[model samples]
Target: MRSVYMDHSATTPVKPEVVEAMLPYFTEIYGNASSVHAFGREARKGVMSARNTIAEYIGASVDELFFTAGGTESDNWAIRGVAHANKQKGNHIITTTIEHHAVLHVCEMLEKEGFEVTYLKTDADGLISLKDLEAAIQPSTILISIMAVNNEIGTIQPIEEIGQIAKKHGVLFHTDAVQALGKIELDVNKQNIDLMSFSAHKLYGPKGIGALYVRKGTRIKNLMDGGAQEKKRRPGTENVPGIIGFGKAVELAAEGFEENNARLIRLRDKMIAGIEATIPYIRLNGHRTKRHPGNVNFCFEFIEGESLLLSLDLVGIAASSGSACTSGSLDPSHVLMAIGLTHEIAHGSLRLSLGEFTTDEDVDYVIEQLKPIVERLRSYSPLYEKATGGTR
Candidate 1:
C-alpha cells in the first residue's frame, strides 16, 4: 500500500533543514540560555537569533514575544493572564463558540471563577458575526478571544475586523493563530492583534515549541511563577534545539510563503474537485474559498467519519474526523455543532488537510479510494437505504 498523509492540521513532519539546524544546538551549543558562562553566551546568541526570526516573521517586537511549551500553554497564559490582571477592571469576556479547547476551556475556567463569558455563535460556514461580536461587548467585557482559523472546518475568521471591534470597545483581543502561522499573512500591528498564540509543529517545525506575541502595554501579567527567564513573564529553562528548529522553519516559511501557498491551493482544489465530482450525498463544510488553503472537509451522509477514517487508513491514507486534540472523544465536533450540523451529519465528516509535502498523486489516490470506501460503508447503513429509497 502506498502511504499518504492528509492530516497537516493535526501535525506536520519536521523538514530536513529544520532538523539540521536543531542538531548543533543539541550537541555543541548545549547551554542554558540563562547561564552566565561562555557556553551560555553562545546559546543565548542562538536563542536571540531564533527569537528575532520569529518576531520578524509576525511583525512583532522581540521583547513582546515569549516562548511557551506550545500552543496550549500560550492560549492559557494569554487568556488567564489578561483576565486575572484586569480583574479589578472587568469580569466579562467575549469568545466564539467554535474556539479550540485551549481557548474554550480557559473561558470555562474563568466562568467558574465568577467571570461572565459570552460565546458568540457561528453561521453554517463556521464564521462568527462581527456585528454580533460588537454587540456582545459590555462595559465590563475585558477580553475578546478568537481563533484566527477554525482547526476542524478550516474557516478563516475575520481577525482584522474583530480586532477593530475589540479596539473600538477598548477590549483586549487575543487570537489562537496556531493554524494561521506560516500559511497565512499575519501582522500583529496591522491586524490590531494585541495577543496571539502559535505552535511550531503545525508548520513543519519541531513539536513542544511555540510562541506568544504580546504587544507592549497590554494589561496582562505572568501566570506562572519561578525563575526570571522569558522576561519573567514565562520562567523556565528554554528548549534550545526546539527553538533553533522553530526559527529555521519560520525562516524557510518566510522565504517560500507565496510559492508554498500557491502549490497547496492548487493541489487542494484538485482533490476537492475530485471528491465533489466522484462522490455523492456529501456536504462540503466551511466556506468554499475563505478558508485555509490546504483544508478540505466534507460530510458524507449515511456514512460514519470514524469508519471512513479507518477504511482510508487500511488503504494507507491518513486523515481526520476533527481536531486531533479531541479525536478520541465520542462526542460530535463542537465546531460542526456550532455550524448547525446535526449529530449524525457531523459524525460523517472528514477533514483532508494538505501540506507542503502533499503531492498530486497522493490526492488522486485518496479520491480513487474514497468512492469505493463510501459506497461499501453506505451499503450497510439502514439510513442509506431509507434516504435513497432502496436504490442502492
Candidate 2:
C-alpha cells in the first residue's frame, strides 16, 4: 500500500533542503553561541543570520524575535510573561474556548493564581464574535490571546480585527501562529499583533525549535532567566542546527508562498469534493472558504475518531482527530464542542491537513480508501443502526 500523510497540523516531515542546511551546524560548526572565542562567533553568526531571515519573513525586527523550544514554550512565555509583567495594570486576560492546550492550560493556571479569564465563544463556523470580544473587555483586562488558525478544525481567526479591538481597549494581543506560519501571509506590524508564537516543524523545519515575536515597547517578563541570549528575554544555549533548519524552511516558504498555496488549495478542494460526494451523514467542520488552504475536517456521525484513525493507519493513511498534543485522550475535542457539536458527533471527527509534499495521487488515494472505511466503522456502530433504523 502507498503511504499517505494528511496530518500536517500534527507535525511535518523535515524537507531535504532544510536538512542540508542544518547538517554543517551539527558537526562542522559545533560551538556554543554564548562563548566568546572564534568558534562561538561563527556559531553566533549562523544564529543571527537565521534570526534575520525569520524576522524578515514575518515582517518583524530581528530584536523582536526570540528562539524557543517550540510553539508550546513560545505560547507559555507570551501568556505568562505578558500577564505577569502587566499584572499591576490589570488582572483580566481574554481568550477563546477552542485554543490549543498550551494557551488554554496557561490561562487556567493564571486563573488559579487570581487572574480573571474570559473565554469567548465561537459560532458554528468556529469564529469568535467581534461584538463578544469588545463586550468582554474590561477596565481590568490587560491581555488577549488567540490562535491565528485553529489546530483541530483549521478555522482562521480574525487576528486583525482582534488586534484592533485589543488596541482600542489598551490590552496586549498575542496569537499562536504555529499553524498559520508559511501557510498564510502574516505581518505582525500590519496586523497590530503584539506577540505571536511559531513552531519550525509546522513549516517543514526540524522539531524542537520555535520563535516568539514581541513588538518593540511591549512589556513582558522573561520566563527563562539566565544568560544574555535572546537579548536577555529567553535564556539557554540556542539550538544552532534546528534554527538553521528553520531559516532554510522560511527561505523556501518565502520563495513561492503564493504558488504553493494555490496548488494546496486545489488539492484540498478536490479531496473535500470527492469525500463529500461519496460519504453520507457527514458534516464538514470549519468555514468552507475561510479555512486554511490545506485543511479538511469532517464529522462522520456514529463512529469513533480513534477507530477511524487506526483503520486508516492500517491502510497506510495517516490522519488525525485534532492536535497531536491532545491525542490519546478519550474525551471529545474541545474545539468541536466549542463549535456546538454534540459529544457523539465530535467523537467521530477527522482532520486531514495537506502540505507541500502532498500530491494529487495522495488526495485521491485517501478519498478512495475513506468511503469503505467509514462504511465499515458505521456498520459496527450501534448509534448508526439506531439512527438509520436498520437501513444499512
Candidate 3:
C-alpha cells in the first residue's frame, strides 16, 4: 500500500530545493561560522543571508532575528529569557492553556522560581477571549506568550489584538509562530509582536534549525551563555547548512504562499466534510473558519486516538493525536480538554494537517479507509452502545 502523510504539523518532508541549497554547505563550504577564515566567511555569509530571508518573510529586521535549534528552543528562549531579564519590572507571565509544552513548561519552571503565571482559558472553539486576557493582567505582568496558531486544533488566535493589549498594559508579547510562519502573513510591526518563534521543519525546510524574532530594543537575557552568536542572545555554533535550507524554503513558501494556502484549505475542507458525511457521531474540533488552512481535527466518538492512529497506519495513512513530543503519553491532549472536550472525546481526537505535497488522492484515501476503521472500533466499544442508546 502507498503511504499518505497528513501530519505536517508534526514535521514536513524537506523540500527538494531546500535540500539542494543545503548540499554545498555540508561538503564544499563546511566551516565554523565564527571563524575568520575564507570558508568561515562563506559560511557566515550564508547564515546572515538566511537570517535576512527569514526576517523578510516576517517583516522583522535582520538584526533582530536569532537562530535556534528549532521551535522548542526558540520558544524556551523567548519566554524564559524575557521573564528572567525583566524580573525587575515584573514577575508575572500570562499565556493560554492551549499553548505547546515549550511555552507551558517554561512558564512552569518560572513559577517554581518565584514567578507567577496566569493560564487563560480558551472557548469551545479554542479561542482565547480578549476579556479573559484583560482580566488576567496584573501590575506585575511582564510578558504574554501565545501561539500564533494552535498546533493541535489549528485555531488562529487573535494575535494582533493580543499584541495591542499587551502593549497597552506595557507587557512584552511573544508568539510561537512555529505553525503559522509559512501559512499566514506575519508583520511583527503591524501586529506589535515583540518576540516570535518559528521552526523550519514545519515549512518544508531542514530540521534542527529555527529562528526567534526579537524586535529591536526588546531587552532579553541570553539563553545559552557562550559565544557572541545571535548577538549574544543565543550561543552556539550556527547550523550553516540548516540555515541555508531554511532560507530556500522560506523563499519558496513566500513565492507560492497564497496559491498553496488556498489549495490546502480546499483539501482540508473536503477532507473534513467527507469524513463528517461518512462517519457518524463525529465532532469537528477548533474554529470552523478562523483556523489554519492546512489543519483538520476531528473527534470520532467511542474510539481512542491511539487505536485510530494504529488503524490508520495499517492502511498506510499518517496522522497524529496531538504534538509529536507527547505522542507516547496515555493522557488525552490538554489542548482538547482546554477547548471543553471531555476526556473521552479528547482521547478520540485525531489531527490531520496537510502541506504543499498533499494531494486530493491522499484525502480521498483517508476518507475511504477511515470510515470502516471507525466503525470497527465502535463495534467493539461498549461505551458506543451506551452513548448511542443502542444494544451491542
Candidate 4:
C-alpha cells in the first residue's frame, strides 16, 4: 500500500530546491553570522539574502524581518514583546478564541502577569466578526493578535479590516501568518499589520526557522537577551542553512503560488465534494468559500474520530482527528469548539490539509478509503443504530 500524506498544515516536506540551496551553507560556509571573518561574512550574506527574499514575499523591508526558532517563538515574542514594551500605554490585549496555541498560550501567560486578555468569540464559520472586534476594544488595549489563516480549519480572518480597527483605536495589530505566508499574498503595508509571524516549515522550508515582521518603528521589547543578533530582538547564533533553505522555498512559493493555489483548491474541493457525496451524515467545517485552498475539515457523525483515524491509517492514509482521550486529553480541538461545534461533533472532526504535492489520485484514494472506514466505525456506534433504525 502506498502512503498518502494529508497533513501539510502540521508540516510539509522540504522542497528539493530548498534543500539544494541549503547544502552549500552547511559544509562550505559554516560560520557564525556574528563573526567578522570571511567565513562569517559568507554566512551573514546568506542570512541577509534570505531575509530580503522573505521581506519581498510579504512586502516588508529587510530591516523589519527577524528570524526565530519557528512560529511559536515568533508568536510568543510578538505578543509578549509588544505587551511589555507598550505597557505604559495599555495593559489589555485582544485575540480570538480560535488562534493556534502559540498565540493563545502566550495570552494566557500574559494574563498571569497582571495583563488583561480578551478572547473574542467567532461565529459558526470560524470567523471573528469585525463588529465584535470593534466592541471589544478598550481604552487600555495595546495589541490585537489574530491569525491570518486558521491552522486547523483554514478559515481566513479579516486581517486587513482588523488592522484598520487596530489603527483607528491606536493599538498595534499582529497576525500569525504562518499558515497564510505561501498560501496567500501578504502586504504588511496594505494590510496595516504592525507585526506578523511566519514559519518556514509551513512553506516546504526547513523547520526550526521562522521570522517575525515587526514594522519599523513599532516598539517591541526583545524576548531573548544576549548578542545583538536579529537586531537585539531575538538572540542566538543564526541558523544559516535553514535561513537559506527558507529563502529558496519562499522564492519558489512566490513564483509558483498562483498555479499551485489553483491546483490545490481544485483538489481540496474535489475531495470535499466527493467525501460529502459518498459519506452519510458528514458536516463540513470552516467557511465554505473563504478558506485556505488546501484545507478541508469535516465531522462524520456517530463515530469517534480516533477510531476513524486509526482505520484510515490501517490502509496507508495519514489523517488527523480532534478527539481527546482521557489520559493524554488531546480532546476536541479548541478551534472547532470556538466555531460552535458541539462536543460530540468536535470529537468526530477530521482535518485533511493538502499541499503542493497532493495529487488527484491522492484525493481519490482518501475518498475511496474513507467511506469504508467510516462505515466500519458507524457499524459499532449506538447512535448510528438508533438513527438508522437498526437493531442494537
Candidate 5:
C-alpha cells in the first residue's frame, strides 16, 4: 500500500538538512544561550545566527525579531502584549471572524480583560472586506490582528491593504503568518506589518520553535517573567537545537520556494480538477486563485469530514478537515462557518494541502481513491439521496 501525506499546512516533515544542522546543538554545543561562558557563547552564536537568517528572510531588522515556542505562543504574545502595553492608547482591537483559534481566543481573553474586540466577517470567497475593516475602527481601536493566510481555507488576506488602513488610523497591525511564511512572499517593510507571528514546523523545521517580528519602538508588555531572554519579551532557556534547525529550514525553504511552489500549485490544480470532474454536489472552498499554492479544499455534500479523513487514513492518505488543533472537536470548523458554509456542508469539508514532498503520482492516487470513497459514503447518507433526488 503506497502512502501520501498532504497535510503540510498543519505541519511539515523536517528536512534532512535541517536535522543535520541541529544535530551539533543537541550534544556538541549544548549550553544555555544566556550564559557568558564559552559553551554558552557557542549556543548563543547559533541562536543569533538563526535569528539573523529569519529576520533577513522576512526583511526585518535583527533587533526586531524574538524567538518563541511556536505560533500559539507568538499569537498570544502579539495580541495580549500589545493590548496591555497600549492600554493608554486604546482598549479596542479588530480581527476577522475566520482567524485561527490562536488569534480568536486571545482576543476573547482580552475582551474579558476590559478590551473591546470587533470581529469583521468574511465574504463567500473568504476575503475580508477592506471597507468593513475600515468601518470597524474607532477612537478606541488600538490594534488590528489578522492572519496573513488562513490556516483552514488557505485564503490570502489583504494584509498590505489592512496594514495601510491600520497605519492611517494610527493603529498597530499584527498578522499571524504561520501558514504564509514559506508559501508566500512577505516583507514586513513593504506590507507595513508592525508585528507578525511565525512557526518553523510549518516550514519543514522543528516543531518546538517559532519567532515573532516586532517593529522597532513597538510597545509590547512581557508575557513571561523570568530571565532576560528574547529581549525580556519572552523569557526562558532557548531551544538552541530547534533554532538551528529552523535557520537551516528557512535557508532551504527560501532557496527552493519558487520551484517548489510552482510544482505544488500544479499538483493542487490537478487534484482540484480531477475531484471536481468526478465528484458531484461538491463545493470548492476558498478563493480559486488567490489561495495558497498547495491548498485544495472542498465540501462533499452529505458525507461527514471525519468519515472521509478516517477512510483516507485507511488508504495511507493523510489530510485534514481544518487546523490540526481543532480536529478533535465535534463542532464544525469556525472558519467554514465564517465563510458562510452551513453546519451540514462544513461537516463534510476536506482539506488537502500539498508540499515540496508531494508528487504528481500522489495527486493522481488521491483523486482516484477519493472519488469512490465519497460515493461510498454518500450512499449511506440519506441526505445525499434526498439532495440528489434519489439518483443513487
Candidate 6:
C-alpha cells in the first residue's frame, strides 16, 4: 500500500532544507541569545537574521516580530496582551465561533474575567459578514480578533475588508494567521492587521517555534517574564535551531509561492472532485473556492469520521477528522457546527489537506482507496440501510 499523508494542516514534515539550515545551531555556534559573550553574539546574529527573513517575507519590520513557542502561545499573547494593555480603552472584543480553540478558549477565559466578547456569526460557507462585524463594533470595543483562515474547514476570512472595518472604528485588529502565514499573501500594512500569529511547523519548519507580528505602536503587553530575550516581550532563551529552521522554511515557502499554491490547488480540487463524484451522500464543506489551496473537507453521510479515518489508515492513507488538537474528543467539530451542519453530518466529517510533499499519485491513490472504504463503512450503518432502503 502506498503511504499518503494528507494532514498538513495538523503539521508538516520539516523540509530537508530546513533541517539542514537548523543543523548548524545544534553543534557549532551554540550559545544562548541572552548571553553577552562572543559565542552568544554569533548565535544572536543567526537569530536576528532569521527574524529579519520572516519579518521581511510578511512585510513587517524586524522590531515588530517576536519569537514564541508556537502559534498557540502567539495567539494567547496577542489576545491577552492586547486585552490587558488596552483595557482602559475598552472591555469589549469581537471574534467568530469557528475559531480554533486557541482563540476561542482565550476569549472564553476573558469573558469569565468580565470582559465582553461579541462572537460574530459566519454564513453557511464559513465566511463572516462584514456588516455583522461593523455593527458589532462598539465604542467600548478594544480589539477585533479573527482567524485569517479556518483550521478545520479552510475558510479564508475577508481579512483585508475586516481590517478596513476595524480601522474605520478605530479598533485594534488581530488575526490568528497560524494556518495562513505561508499559504496566503499577508501584508501587515496593506491588511491593516495590528497583530498576527504564525507557526513554523505549519509551513514545513521546525515544530515548537513561532512568531507574533505586533505592528509598531500596537498596545500589547508581554505575556511572559524572564530573561531579556525577544526584546523582553517574550523573554526566554530563543530556540536557535527552531528559529533558523523557521526562517529557512519561510524563505523556501516564498521562493515558489505562486507555483506551489497552483500545484496544491490542482491537487486539492482533484481530490474534492474525485471524492464528490465517487462517494454517495457526501457534502463538501467550506467555501468552494475561497479556501486554503491545500484544504479539502467534506461530510460523508452515515459513517462516523473516526471509522472513516481508521479505515483510511488501514489503507496507509493518513487524514484527519478535524483539528488535531481536538481529534481525541468524542464531540463533533465546533467548526462544522458553526457552519450550520447538523450533529450527524458534523460527526462524519473528514479533512484531507495537501502540502509540498504531496503528489498527483498520492491524490490518485487516495481517490482510489476512499470510495471503497466509505462504501464499506456505510454498508454497516443502520442509518444508511434505512435511508437507502438496503439498496446501497
lDDT of 3 by residue, 1-392 (tens): 97999999999999889999999999999999999999999999998899899898888889999888999999998998898899999899999899999999999999999999999998999999999998899999999998999999999998999999999998899999999998988999889999999999999999899989998888798987888887877888889999999999999999999999999999999999999889888889999999999999999888899999999999899999988989999999999998888998899999999989899999999999998999889989988988778853
Q: What would the TM-score be for candidate 4 when compared with the true structure?
A: 0.97
- Candidate 2, RMSD to the unseen true structure: 0.9
**For each candidate, how many residue pairs have backbone atoms clashing (under 3 Å)?**
0, 0, 0, 1, 0, 0
Model 1, span 37-74: residue lDDT tens: 99999999999999999999999999999999999999
**Pairs that collide, model 6:** none
* TM-score of candidate 3 on Cα atoms, chains taken together: 0.98
Please list the C-alpha lDDT of all candidates, in the order they appear: 0.94, 0.94, 0.92, 0.90, 0.93, 0.94
What does candidate 5's lDDT look like per residue over 1-392, in tens digits? 98999999899999999999999998899989999999999999999999999999999999999989999999999999999999998999999999999999999988888999999999998999999999999999889999999998999998899999999989999999999988999999889999999999999999999999999989999888998898777888899999999899999989999998999889999999999999889999999999999999998888999999999999999999988999889999999999898999999999999999898999999999999999999999888888889997
TM-score of each: 0.99, 0.99, 0.98, 0.97, 0.99, 0.99
TM-score: the better of candidates 4 and 6: 6
lDDT of 2 by residue, 194-286 (tens): 999999999999999999999999999997789988888898888999999999999999997999999999999999999999999999999
Off by over 4 Å in 1: none
Off by over 4 Å in 2: none
The residue ranges of model 5 lying beyond 4 angstroms of the native Cα positions read none
lDDT by residue (tens digit), candidate 4, 260-364:
999999999999999989998888999988999999999989988888888888899877773111214557888888888889988898889999999899999
Error of 3 at 302 (Å): 0.9
> What is the Å distance of residue 391 in model 2 from its true position?
2.3
Flag the better candidate by TM-score, 1 or 4. Answer: 1
